[model samples]
Target: MWIVLLLPIVAYIFIQIAFCRVKSQSKYLRNVPGKRPFLIFGNLLDFLPGSIVFLDNLMGYLKTYGDTILFHDGSFSWILLSIDYEFNEFLYSSSVHIEKSDQYQFFHGWFGQGLLTSSGSTWRNHRKVITHSFHFSILLQFIDVFDSVGDNLVKKLESEAGKDSVEISQLISLYALDVICEAAMGVKIQALEAGNSEYVKSIKEMCNIVVDRVFSFISPRLYKLTWTYYREKTALKVRGFVLA
Candidate 1:
């Protein structure tokens, strides 16, 4: 009688283990009508960060599943609804439940409860503020600022060209940094001239760290804590240096 009782317990344990295994494997398994994602990376490994593999992945899925492809991006499931003419018309015509996903909350730790990351009433208020700030008249007034910055960038690029080839990425990043600093904060960065400015260095480091966090398989809460500390420390240093 003891043996019989032990057998049922053992069977239940085995079944539970099997179920757990299935659940873990289910994210990579292709149930939807599209090309199967990679076993481990799930169509993201090649496409992440600097690479343009996302286009190829989308094309592959389009060939197999038409316009709309349903796939799991790691643990997060997404519906890749194409921007075809018919789909665009359908989307615009509907007054439906169009809200940002829960996954977007992951960015809140990095961007704070800011407009881009926040939701509901907070986002609504942010939108109102931004709309007022970016009125047509305001944008028109900024046109001369844009033209002056553009001329400076072209002149700088012309000056930096070597006999061989230049590091295009670094140069473009500096140009963009300069433009953003001037446009947003009304402060000149001169990142190309100083190359290793504290603010530019910190921003580049922070960007790399954020990208690393985005691709990590760790829990979002833990990642948020780690990134928040790094971001705050780096930001304080940058702010101090900039003010000084």
Candidate 2:
């Protein structure tokens, strides 16, 4: 009983100590726009209760903070979020800013060292190899695949036309998946017709897990302690098995 009682006090003390150490380093970013951060927790408390509202809450922040905002995690590691056109243009156009953020590691397990997760010379090489695939002439060949997918999408949407409300995002996603599978791999998975397949189910679940991880206040290294981590790994295995 005594040990359990003391645990909270001990944890609080440690967090305060850690926060003090990092506070000076992050002081410069305090002037930036966004919600005022709390000790140790930063802006993480705002995301609690339901992480499923992450996207909606992010939109709210954009409205409150304009284009550029600053946020930090529990560890007081500050990150600048920007949707300003000039800032994005500069970041993407500059060769010096080729490196991606550490948060991208969350995708490493599923995407491997593919273009999205790779950087530096590896990214350059991957981009060069795939550059021709997106050429106008090459993309023109996929028109039939797009038309077929669009037809399937229209048929699916027609089924939902009279409903009081319709969630079209998932429908569009399935259409894109079908098109990609058929055009890229020559495999007609018919994702729109069979969106509940284990592979597609796993893809959706894995995507949610990734988004949750990004918004989570806990450290990614500690994810092994949670059931969601195992679920994500299982989803990855399912996806890999289906792809193979």
Candidate 3:
């Protein structure tokens, strides 16, 4: 009973320390410009509307802050946004700065620690292994797959050509998926032809869940209590959806 009572106190103390640490880190970036953060939520509220709105807001920030801005999701997450060529070159051309940002944690469930999510020596090794897969000659071999997929996409657009309005985004996503599966995995999932297939729908749903999770302000530990988490868990069970 006493331990339970002390739990809140312990948690509060831990949070205070973490908050203080974040504050100290921010002091170095004080000269960096960004929208003033809110209490606890930090700059996350600015990005909650959706990707389009977030991109609009980000473009405004770029105009106002002149790139190389600093912001954080919460006290524990400090992010540096830089678009300067020299800064980007320095970061990408060096092995010392190979760590990904906190946002990539959301991809852990879907991609595990593969190329997109891994870092340090693991990332280096993965990059080495996959380097040949993207070589010009290797990519040229997939031209047939691309040509077939492009033909399908053209036919899809042609069918929707005189419509009042058509949502081509979903069609394009399916097109890309079909290409990736055929070229990379050596399997034809036919995502465009079978748009409503369980494989295609599960992939789309998983993407939606991941995007939502990235913008969500809730604690990940509490994710199990939400429907989205359960849905994501179920989607991961889709057979033949090999995750790297």
Alpha carbon lDDT of each predicted model: 0.64, 0.81, 0.83
Write the number of the candidate with greater TM-score, choosing between 1 and 3.
Answer: 3
lDDT by residue (tens digit), candidate 1, 98-183: 35654665555445676766666776778768978876777776677678767876777888776477777887788777777777
lDDT of 3 by residue, 11-77 (tens): 9998889788887988888998888888888888777735568888878878898868877766377
Give per-residue CA lDDT, model 2, range 1-244, as digits (tens). Answer: 9999999999999788777766775677777788877865777766654567767877888899989988775555667889999998998877667888667888887888878887899988998899888779998889999998899999999999999988889898898889888898888888899968877898888887886777676677798899988898888877554477
By lDDT, who's the top model here? 3
How far off is residue 124 in model 2, in Å? 2.1
Q: What is the TM-score of each predicted model, taking all chains together?
A: 0.63, 0.83, 0.86
In candidate 3, which residue ranges exceed 4 Å CA deviation? 1-8, 49-52, 83-86, 239-244
The regions of model 1 sitting more than 4 angstroms off are: 1-34, 37-41, 44-70, 79-98, 167-169, 224-244
RMSD list, candidates in order: 6.9, 3.5, 2.7
